[model samples]
Target chain A: MIEFDNVSLRLSAFALHEVSLTIMAGDYYFIMGPSGAGKTILLEALAGLHIPDEGRILLKGEDITGIPPEMRKIGLVYQDYSLFPHMTVEKNIGFGLRMQGLHHPERKKRVDTLMKKLGVGHLAQRAPLTLSGGEMQRVAIARALAIEPEILLLDEPLSALDPIMRDFFVDELRELHREQGLTIVQVTHERHEALNLGTRMALIRDGRLEQEGAIDDVFVRPRTRTAAEFMGFENIIPGIVSDAGGPDCRFDTGTVSFSCSTKAIKGENGAVCIRADDISVREKTDPGTDRDNTYRGKIVAVNPSGPMVRIDVDIGLNIVMVMSRKTFESRHLKKGSEIVLTVSPDDIYIISTGTPDTTCS
Target chain B: MTSRIKPDLCLISFALVGSTLVILILLALLNITATQLSDIPFLLQVAQDSRVTDSILLTFTAGLNAVIILVLLGTPLAYVLARTHSRFNNIIESIIDIPLVLPHTVAGIMIYLLFMQRGLIGAPLKDVGFIFEDAYPGIVAAMLFVALPFYVDTAREGFEKVPLHLENVARTLGATRFRAFSLVVFPLSIRHILNGCILAWGRAISEFAAVIMIAYYPMVISTLIYYRFTTGGIKESTAIAFLMILASFSVFVLLRLVTRYVGRYDDRV
Candidate 1:
């Protein structure tokens, strides 16, 4: 396990403010944040590149805070691959082994094994500059893995590739993790990539850890407005709990009321985060749904984005819902169309409660 | 057709004006070669002359030694300057470039004051039997002083062209800072380093005012050519000048060919 105990760092215009996180052994942890959010700084800190000014970094319960990167036994791969242009593919892959003083025969064997495993054996003699983007990425990964690091740190690894290549490498990385049982820490801004690959994840904003937990908990139940916004929670309704005695509560937004499940007391001020895909939309004439958290609204906008369509409905309050293009086309939805929207009580997560003045608005 | 031909004519005129200096240099070299070739026996006699051969050899050896010292000392400074960004580094960069703008005579005077016998550095060294007065050390000092900026600036440019992340990756791969630089940064910047050495050696060998100010004896080719011109008229000096030119040209051509071969993988980086 790796643990970051309230780490704080200041680098020129950017600063990480007492951020803390943990990654267990064999866990694929993804760090997600917006651009300039200090995600890469946190990853580099874990890799021993940046020494923290305020806290200790523990590796497997041992304090390794002041250790240098070379002795940390952690490998870092950048998005650009950063393969040495002076070396050929084989040499680049074997660079780590050579650095560790491995003998010729053993080094060559390890390099050959990694090259064949990563499917770049045929390009061993070719220089990095001559390789394709995918080829260079594999070579970089192989080079990192040749060290047999306890944890591999990747900085936006798939962001540099095209969609097709990204999917291919995502599977490659998954298999590598499973076959080798290697702990991986990836930093990216893409939410889907994190959801697809991460067992645990953390969301950072403005150099602070907004939320971190198991993948299902962080994604399905974001703990703050910023975390919810980043996790694609399109409908964040701030309200005061009007009736809260049991697992179910009536949340009043002054304009619209929602029955959501929460553990807060009555008169608590908080917000309910609901994913766009969780809210179901239907024509007003099509009935058979219960009226627990249902509302009548008019479609305000329809945006078709490749395979998905985003619809904005104004039900006294604006709520966004995403559906498949086929579903949208079959429903014949358009602007100014009357529609019924239903959201399950379990799908709504309450957050930012207890502090009345600091409630999200 | 007329409109297209007008631009072509304008371009040709521009090319002709721009190539005037090149044309003049070629014309001068050809004129000297043609004149010297007509008197084959006299040219052969000049080539066999001990003074001409010694001066040429001295010039090359001193210039080469100065260049080697510059590479050893200037490379670290160049790499640091390339990778660092600060107000102090900017000040240091400006100081390194001072030699480039100084007049050769002024530079010669500066070298004379610093390394002359009983001078600041020369006085201490003189106590140890290392004299800089009309000696080989003085010749090399003058050459090194004038040629430092050429090597530092060119090598710095080369180091700047290499991305920093490559070295960072190497460090993570279990290499220390020095190992990372030697394995990754040095090989990538070799082409620029060689080019810098060539430029610095050329500058060192061509330096005349400075070498003469400190060491007129053990004459370099430049000093010998100047001396020959002062005592023996244009005809006598021309022979030594022709031989020096032939030797310098041959070395430069060979160095350029080697540089081309070494820099074949330059564009890939």
Candidate 2:
């Protein structure tokens, strides 16, 4: 486990602002933000590479703020892999062990096991420059893991790989977490990687922690409009809380009235959040479906993504919804076609007024 | 395509000018060596002379020793200059380049005053039974005086080319600062360091005025050649000069081959 307690660092032209985070044991934690959002700075602060200007860092319940990176028992890998080019793959993997004063036989055994696990054993004798990007990344991972540190910090680990390679690496990382039970805190700007492997994620914006919780909670129920937008929630409808109660709450947007799930006080101004995938399109006369919230809108665009079709509907406010391609074909939806949209009250999240609602282009 | 023999006029002109300058130097060296071709036996005999052989050996040994010292002292200095960002670093770097601009005779004079018997360093060093005036130590000191900048500058470039992130990664992998540099940086920048050593050694071996002003008795190859030219006439000096050329050429070739092998992994890092 790692804890960043109000850690602040001031680098020239960039900084980390009182950032605090807690990563649990065996947690595949993700720090998600746009590029230049100081996400990497936080990761480095945790690694003790950059001494914080403000707070303390506790590792395994002990203060490691004063410890140097070499003594911190942390492993970090970069997007470029940053493997030692002068050493062969085997030597590169074995460097940390040799640095730890491990004897030759023991070092060899450990290195061989790691290389075999990472599927880079055949590249042991080859120079790093000769290996592909994935191979080099595997070697770098082996090298970092050879030291057997308490935590592994990755800075955009899969950003340098092709799409296919990135997918493969993501699966490998999931397997690595499952099999080794290593606590990994990786930082990336790609939304899918965070959504895929992160057990817990913290969304950062302009050096501020916007939201932090389980991945499903943060994604389905973002705490702020900015957090919702960052997490790819495209439908944010402005509304005022008319009736706030236990099971269902009534919201009035001056254009339409809907029921959502919330605990806010009555007369509280807020916005309703809905994920694109949570909205379904149907005919206006479908009496068999007993949806709690329904609205009529005109389809503005029909975009196909793989086997799914995404429709942008203007139901007073533009809301994007996705459905299967087969459903789209059977319904015979097209641009300029009028339809009704249905969403469950559980999928509707309310963000109260006075919370920062910033959006980035 | 129409002309079937289109010439790159700008490139042709540049090549012509460059080749002319290079050919002039090559022809001058070949001409000198060919003029003494008939005197090969005479040159061999002069090479067999104790004074001639001793001066050549002394030059090589002193030059190599100077380069070794440069490696020990200049590497850290170069690393600091490359990594540190401040006005003070800039001033110190400019001061290091002073030896390159100052005339060799002026450097020799400065070193002479600094290492003379009554001089500040010389007096203290003499108290410890080591003298620099008219001694082998003075020869090496003079060579080091004018040749240190090449090694430091070249090595500094090498250090700058290595990204600091690599060392940081090494530290995260449980390597101390010194360990990371020795294992990662030193090996990666070795080719450039070797290049610097060759340049520094070459400059030291070819030095004449500096060595003559400080240690004229234990003549280096340069000093011995000048002495022979002045007193023993052109014929004897030419034979010795030709022999020195052969020795220098052989060493340069060997160094080039070593540098070539080392360069194979240069781009990899």
Candidate 3:
């Protein structure tokens, strides 16, 4: 278990603002944000490589904020592996044991067991430089695990590889976690990567964790506008709740009206949040099946995106609908075509109107 | 990654000039012995004297001492320099390289003056019973002064090449600053350190002016050769010169083999 209790750290151009998180035993947590968002800083802090400016860190419920990284019993893996070039694969795996004053024969035995587990037994005698990317990663993991650390921290471990290798390495990393049941804290900016690898994900923005939840919950339901936008929603427009319909609210988007699902929707002017994929396109004559939140508009633009088409409609107010290539081609939609934009009342959630005031949360 | 190459005449001329200079140095060194070539065997036998053996041994000892001291003292300095972000780092690095380009005789005089008992470094050093004049210490000091650049430069290069990421990774892996340097930085630099030692030893063995000014009693091979040439005629001098060549050549080959064995992992080929 690793916990950051109100930890604040300052680095060259980034600072973590009073970050407090608890990572339970056997949890695979990924903290994600854009570049310079302090993801690396937080990981380094957990490892005890950089002391936080404020607050204490705890491991297994014991305060370890002042402990050195090695003594903290936390293992760290870098993107490039940082394998000891002078040592053979087995030696690299056994380095921590050697450091701990373990006997050579005993170290070798443990290393061999780990090599078999990682399917790298044949590579024991080879130098690390001779190994492939996947092979090296396994070696690094084995090296870290030799000491049986309480927690394992990976800093963008797959960021150095090509796209294809990334999937393979991620799978291998997942397997490693499953086999060891080690507390793993991975930091990455790639949303898809975090979504795939993390049992629970923390979305960080501007040095603060904006939201954190299980992958499914965080993906389908984000708590804030920033969280939704970070999850790949590109179209966000401003609007105001004109009427409180008790169960559902009517938002006046100036040019276009939208019905949102805000339970406490009273006296609020905010942005109406609709994921581009939530908007559907159909011909006007036969209105699409009973979805209450629908608008008629002319297709203002149909732009080609990789494997998806992003179509913009001007229902007097411009709104976007993103669809897969098949749906896009099937609808025979063009920029000049006239279509109805339909969204479920559930799909259009209300995002707090202006910049969220300091006390909004 | 690259564009087509364009050859220039100036570079070709530069390389030609370099090769010719090496050839000229070799020819000049060998020229004095041509006339007395027939009497070489007798001269060669005379060259294997106590004087020749002692001089060679002394030179080797001093060079070894200087190199070992440099490694012990210079490593931490190099690492500190590597970590610094200060603008002063450039000035210090450039200053370290001054010995590399400075004239040998001029360096010898500088080292002499610095260690003259009444002079800056010498007065303090003398308090520790390290009398530099006409002693083995003087010879070693001269060698160290001339060869300082090789170790410092190579060591700095080694420190720089052990990428910052590797150190960070070590730190994250639970290693402390000192532990990280010992395991990661030190191992990575061993090969470079060996190379520096070889270069330093080469410079030390070939040094003449500095040793002459500081220590004349414990005569190194170069000084012995000069002393022999002035006292005895060219025949006697050629014998000592040729013997020194053979002895230095064999020692160099041995050092090369050892360095290769130790650094086989670092060898790309």
Candidate 4:
């Protein structure tokens, strides 16, 4: 188990601040953020590459905050494998064991088994420069693991590979994770990779950790407005409270009204989020006329991305709702066409927008 | 751009530059006298001379010794300069190139003043039974002073380019800082060190003035060549010059092969 308590790291242009995290034994955790959000810094802090200024880091209940990186039993795999180009794959993989002065035959036997398992057994005789990127990455991992580290850390391991090769490499990593049950702390900018690999994810934003939970829990429901937006919730419709005294309050957007779930915590200026799949688009503006959450919107644009198309509908309030391509195609919605959008009260997720829409705006 | 030279101008410049370089080579090759060319076979009589063999051995040993000392001490210093960002690092780096620019004769005078028997360091050393004025130490020092820029500059470049991330990965692989440098940094920079050795050896062999000051008694091949040219005449000097060319040529071939082997790993770019 690795635990970070109130860790804060200040570097050149960025900081990883007050980040407290727990990596349970055998858990696969991912740290994800946008560029400059200090994902890499967080990984470095955990690996003992950078010591946190304000906090303590404990590995297996022992404070390892001051320990040198070499003494820490943590494996790190980077995008560039950092293989010793002068040494053969066998020699590179055997380096750690050799440092420990493991007998020649014993070290060779261990290296051979690892080599076969990684399926690079035949290439052991070759120089690292002669190997492919994927092969080099495997050798790097093998070399790190030859010491049998207590935990493993990867920093954008697949970012260096091209699209086609990335899939195969990701699969290889998954197989290794399953077989070893090694505690992992992987940092990446790619969301899909985090979702696929992480049993749970810690979301780092700006300098601080925003939130962390099981993958499905965070995906379906996020605590903060920023978290929801980052997780790909595009429907942000504006509305306010009207019947505030009642058990359920109705908020009016002037153009449209919503039976808001955000009524309990009252605010004049706020943003509401409804997931793309949650909002249903209808051809005729007939059903649910008297309902609270109904708006007539013009389908501004339709973007087709693989199996799903997201429709941007203008609801006259400078707000847009995104819906699936299948739903848009079935309904036959086109640009410059009129459509009606409806949302359930439970689905009307509204919170204060602290930061501007830098991505969308 | 107007600065772009026209094809006709470029052709003329290229031809002019080629002619100038070829003429310089031609001049050096043509400097020997007709009598010297005729007496070359008679120099074979001098080739069997003990002085000739002793001079070659001394020159080769000193050059090799200078290179060995440079590698032993200079590589680690280069690595530190490569990795450190302190103000002193830049100052030290700029100072490293001073020997290449300073007149070798001036360096020789400086060494003579500092290390002669009555001079500052040599006075105490003489009490300890150490000799510096006309010995192998002085010869090796002279060669080292002139030959070091090649080693430091090349090795520093090698260390600078080996991305710091590689060393970090080595550390994470459970190797200590010392182990990382030994297992990762040293091996990766071997080619650059090879480049340094070749340049240093080439510089050392071609050195004249500094060697002329420090150890005139125990003659190196360069001093021997100078002696023969002034005393025994041009015939003997050209023959020794020819032998130096042959010796340097084979090492040059070896360097080319090694560079090609390294170039395969990292593309020329």
Give a tens-digit lDDT track for model 2, residues B164-268: 878889999889888888888888888889999999999999988888787887889888888888999999888888888889999999998998888456365
* Per-residue lDDT over A254-283 for candidate 2, one digit per residue giving the tens place of the 0 to 100 score: 887778866666777788888899888655
DockQ of each: 0.54, 0.50, 0.39, 0.43
Clashing pairs in 4: A309-A325
lDDT of 2 at A25: 93
Flag clash pairs in model 3: A69-B174, A70-B174, A270-A353
Kindly report which residue stretches of model 2 are placed more than 4 angstroms away from their true locations once superposed. A224-226, A235-260, A263-272, A287-305, A308-361, B1-17, B38-42, B84-87, B227-239, B266-269
- Give candidate 4 regions above 4 Å deviation: A8-18, A162-172, A205-208, A216-229, A235-259, A262-264, A268-270, A285-292, A318-330, A351-361, B1-39, B118-120, B228-236, B258-269
Q: What TM-score results for chain B in every one of the models? A: 0.94, 0.95, 0.84, 0.85
lDDT of 1 by residue, B1-269 (tens): 35543468788898999899999999999999998999989989989999899999999999999999999999999999998777699899889988899998898899989988779999999999999889999999999999999999999999898888888788889988889888888888989999999999999999999899999988999888888899987776898999989999999999999988784553664
Of 2 and 3, the candidate ranking higher by TM-score: 2
**Count of clashing pairs, candidate 2:** 0
Please give, as one word, the docking class of candidate 3.
acceptable
lDDT of 3 by residue, A101-151 (tens): 789989889999999988899999998888888888888888888888868
Chain A fold similarity by TM-score, each prediction: 0.95, 0.92, 0.90, 0.85
**Which candidate leads in TM-score?**
1
Error of 1 at A40 (Å): 2.3
All candidates in order of DockQ, best leading: 1, 2, 4, 3
Between prediction 1 and prediction 3, the one with superior TM-score is 1
